[model samples]
Target: AQTVTQSQPEMSVQEAETVTLSCTYDTSESDYYLFWYKQPPSRQMILVIRQEAYKQQNATENRFSVNFQKAAKSFSLKISDSQLGDAAMYFCAYTDSGGYQKVTFGIGTKLQVIP
Candidate 1:
């Protein structure tokens, strides 16, 4: 069984500033994929960034980055140069390498960008 937890239910950031959203997961599988997804008011799930459990280096995508600690089972997202468009519902998710195709997601953290 795999589970993802986001302690902060809501967060706010200033324009052009940076904000971090925390997430932690528990899983028995050794190999897996961790991800941060963003859902805006449009109701679309967008892939922000991803980290492979086997990789020690974290993953980054432009303004979006992740701090992945496999030992601690923590995967937090950092959004730099935050924009109004960055305001959305951020979800932390997990998927194992096994044949099972299920992806478990957290309750989500709503991010608000203030001008």
Candidate 2:
């Protein structure tokens, strides 16, 4: 079985600052996919970024990027130039490479943007 772990239960950052959320996983499969999802107060799951295990390059989107260490099975999300809207629960998720399937999510880290 595979599992995702987010060490920090809560994180806070000032607007325009940068923050990194830690995430580590345990998996035996060689091929899989990793994802970071954001859920605001609205409770809607939104895909923030994704990384393919087979790819060596880290994935990034706008101000969000990932530090993917395949050998260590660690994937962390870095948020640069943070904004107030970035305040939410960030969840690390994983899915098998077989096909479109359900994802396993971590407990999540709540991010607070301090004014």
Candidate 3:
């Protein structure tokens, strides 16, 4: 079974600074996908970024980027130029290439943007 691990239970950052959240996973499958989802106070799960296990390059979107280490089965999210609106609960998820695939999420890391 694939399981995502988020060692950090909570993190805080200044409104205009950058913060990186750590995430690690254990999977036996060679091919799979990793994702980072953000759930704001509205309780909506928004996709932040995604990375394929076969791909060597990391993925980035605007102020968000990922450090994907396939060999170590580690995937982390970095938020640059953090803003007050960025405060939310970030979750790391994993899915494998199989029928009726289900996403497994970590406990989550609560990010607090300090003004």
TM-scores, all models, native as reference: 0.98, 0.97, 0.97
Candidate 1, residues 35-113, lDDT tens digits: the string is 9999999998998888899999989999989999888999999999999999999999999888776889999999999
Error (Å) of candidate 3 at residue 91 is: 0.2
Selected candidate, larger lDDT, 1 vs 2:
2
For residues 1-115, write the lDDT of model 2, one tens digit per residue.
8899999999999999999999999988999999999999999989999999999999999999999999999999999999999999999999999766779999999999998
Which residue runs of candidate 2 sit more than 4 Å off their true CA positions? none
Worst 10 contiguous positions by lDDT, candidate 3: 93-102
**Which candidate order results from sorting by lDDT in descending order?**
2, 3, 1
- Give Cα distance to truth, residue 20, candidate 3, Å: 0.5
Give residue 62's lDDT in candidate 2 (0 to 100): 98
Model 1 Cα shift for residue 55 (angstroms): 0.6
lDDT of 1 at 97: 89
Compute the lDDT of residue 42 as modeled in candidate 1. 100
